[model samples]
Target: MDDALVVGGTRFIGRHLVAELLAHEYDVTLFNRGNHDNPFAEDGRVDHVEGDRTDDDALEAAARTVDPDAVFDCVAYHPADVRAATRVFEDCEAYVYVSSGAAYGREDIPKREDETPLASCTAEQATNDSRDSYGNRKAEGDRVVFAAADDGVNAMAVRPPIVYGPHDYTERFAFWVDRVRRFDRIVVPGDGTNVWHRVYVEDVASALRVVAERGEPGEAYNVGDRRIVTLERMIERLADTLETDVEVVYAGSRELAAGGIELEDYPLYRDHPHIVSTAKLAELGWESTPLSTAIDRTVAEHLESGRDGRGQGPCRDDENRVLAALDYADR
Candidate 1:
């Protein structure tokens, strides 16, 4: 698409998507509430449309002003938002909604686009603005895309597992980056094989563009790292990226209890592995960033931003207690 509209372009994935669009030489416009600082405010290449996606009138105004060939809905948290945007931008060449892998109702080794069941959203859950209902809401949003596409709207969805990379406000991966950078030895809960699939922000940005350009209407594609890494290996990757050596200690749930820690306390730790098949997205000529390259960019940005991913994981004091317990048990 020669012209693109990115809703909520100032934050993590949206921010990266704008850069990706600009790099590809597409005229870009951002639609957001203007709360977050616009990274492109100084750049003369991008345009901004100040409006709330929640307000139907404001969104309509933006669609008219931009008359974009492609529309990327980054702030669509609820199904209703997707419904409204599809109706407003039905004439666009493509309307892409950013969905999440969490939308998969069941935990599977590798969740696929069409085979895996999507989480069912109750009407109440769809409207509730809570993390507990996030997956359900996102699933409903995907459903909205399907319905819109059925009505001739060129709408598609891309579901990414956990997105990580530079400008990640969630700071989930940054938590581990900080530990690897500052500590010689760090404790990883469980046997350290927990796999929570994560896509780099830049790759996710590219996936959005690919979906918009080449995806079929009514289709939802899963986006993630082509090669998945375990929790332990992820830390190792981070350490390698930082050019540092680290001792990755594995702790069992029972041992972690010595420090009042649970496996859930770890940001990226999961009891069951979570992986999504990206072969579907790749079929459209999309490729993920290499692990080492992704980690290098993430670590470089983490060091520059000084984001320790604080509040995203258990406290260091508690982690130390767990380490002590593990050491005592070893002895």
Candidate 2:
């Protein structure tokens, strides 16, 4: 794609995607609310349009002005948003939506591009509620995009699971990095056997480009590691990568709840592993980023950014509360 437009390109995967686009010699245009510090605002190489993606009028105007060959959407949530955005991108040769793996009906079995059932979504489920998880809503959005294939939008979806790497705002990986550091002892809920699936932010960005350039329209591809990585195994990898000496403490759920804490308090603690297959993406000639590489680079970035690699966990206080309870029990 010689010219392309990205919706919401300021942070995380979007930021990395923009960099990938530039690397491929594609002139890029970014459309967002201009509410945050843009890493690309200074680049003379890109066309910037500051507007709301849901705002039909503004998007249509920008679409006419930029006239890109392919459009990548990173923040589209609801079908309503997709409908509005596609109306603006009607003429683009390719429309790539960045969706999440949560949309799958089942994560236990290895899922393909089309074999898996999509989580049900209703228009009423549009409002944010725990009943309508993001996975189901993304399925709704995916349906909307593929439905537009009839209108010749050349649409496709790239679903990624738990994307982590540099510039991650969620602090998921940072939680591990910090836990490896400054904690003489680390705690994990349960036996730490939960399934973990994730992709590097930059690799996801690259896969998006491959999707935009070569993916079959009206289809979705899973972009992540084919080999499943368990929570405990990854933690062991983290300790090895950071060269940290810490004892791992496994706590039961009963005690955690009694202490006003849950597995959520312990970062990356999950009851089930999110097993996903990237076989489809691999078929498209997209290579998955090694977990070891992703971990090293992420830690290096966190350290280079002047972060002390200490106490970055979101549930630090809650974790301490739970840990204190465990310590009391030991007494």
Candidate 3:
């Protein structure tokens, strides 16, 4: 497809996706509410369609204007959004929706695309805009894509787990990057073996483009790092990237409770490992960025952006209390 229309192209994944599409020589137009600043505003290659995606009229107008060969929906949080988008661009060569790995209902060592059961969404959950219902709603959106495909719409879905890298506003990963860059000794929740699969933002953008060109309709693909790492290894890798040495202090429930903190209070801490299988995406000529390389870029951009990730997790004062308690208990 030579022409593409991206809905929600100004932030995080969507921003990188626009770049990817342009790199592959696709004429790209961004359709958004104009709430956030457009990074590509000055670029002559990218065009902007100012409108809210929730308004079907505005969306239809964009479809009529672009008549793009492909459509990518990055801000579809609810099933209704996906359903409407697929309908509006049903004739496009491909319509890809950005889904989440959380859509899987069951916990497995590595969640696969076809085998894993998806979370259930109710009428109320579908309409309610809450983080608690995010997975359910995303799963329902995948179903909507499937139905659209069955009706001859070239709709596909890509599920990514815990995406991180440059321009990550979530600051979830930044919390650890900051911890390693700023401190000699940092508290790590659990025994440091906690596993939460993460994919780099650029890889996600490439996956969207690949799925648009090569993926089959009515199908969903998982995108994540080909190799997984534990929480301890992740921090160690970060320290390596920053050329620093620090002690990784493990804090359990008891140790954290000394500071009135719970393991769950820490960001990226999961009792059970959350992993997704990427063999499917790999088959479509998709690969992930190396952990070390991805880390280097993430840390560098983080330093430049000056995002401390303070609001993303527990405060340092609280962590210091936990550390002091650990020190006392050790003595």
Which wins on lDDT, candidate 1 or candidate 3? 3
lDDT per residue for candidate 1 within 98-192, as digits (tens), equals 99999999887788888999999999999999989999999999999999999999999999999999999999998999889989999998888
Can you rank all candidates by TM-score, best first?
3, 1, 2
Sliding window of 10 residues with minimal summed lDDT for model 1: 321-330
| Residue 5, model 2, lDDT | 94
Residue range 1-331, candidate 3, lDDT tens digits: 8999999999899999999999999999999999998999999999999898999999999999999999999999999999899999999999999999999999977898989999999999999999899999999999999999999999999999999999999999999998898999989998999999989999999999999999999999999988899999999999999999989999999998878888988878889999999999999999888878888998999999999887888888999999998888889
- Per-residue lDDT of model 2, residues 16-41, tens digit only: 99999999999999999988789987
Candidate 3 wrong stretches, greater than 4 Å? none
Please give the CA lDDT of all the candidate structures: 0.93, 0.81, 0.94
Question: What is the lDDT ranking, best to worst?
Answer: 3, 1, 2
Model 2 spans with C-alpha error above 4 angstroms: 127-132, 306-331
> Is candidate 2 or 3 superior in TM-score?
3
**TM-scores, one per candidate:** 0.98, 0.91, 0.99
lDDT comparison, 2 vs 3, better candidate = 3
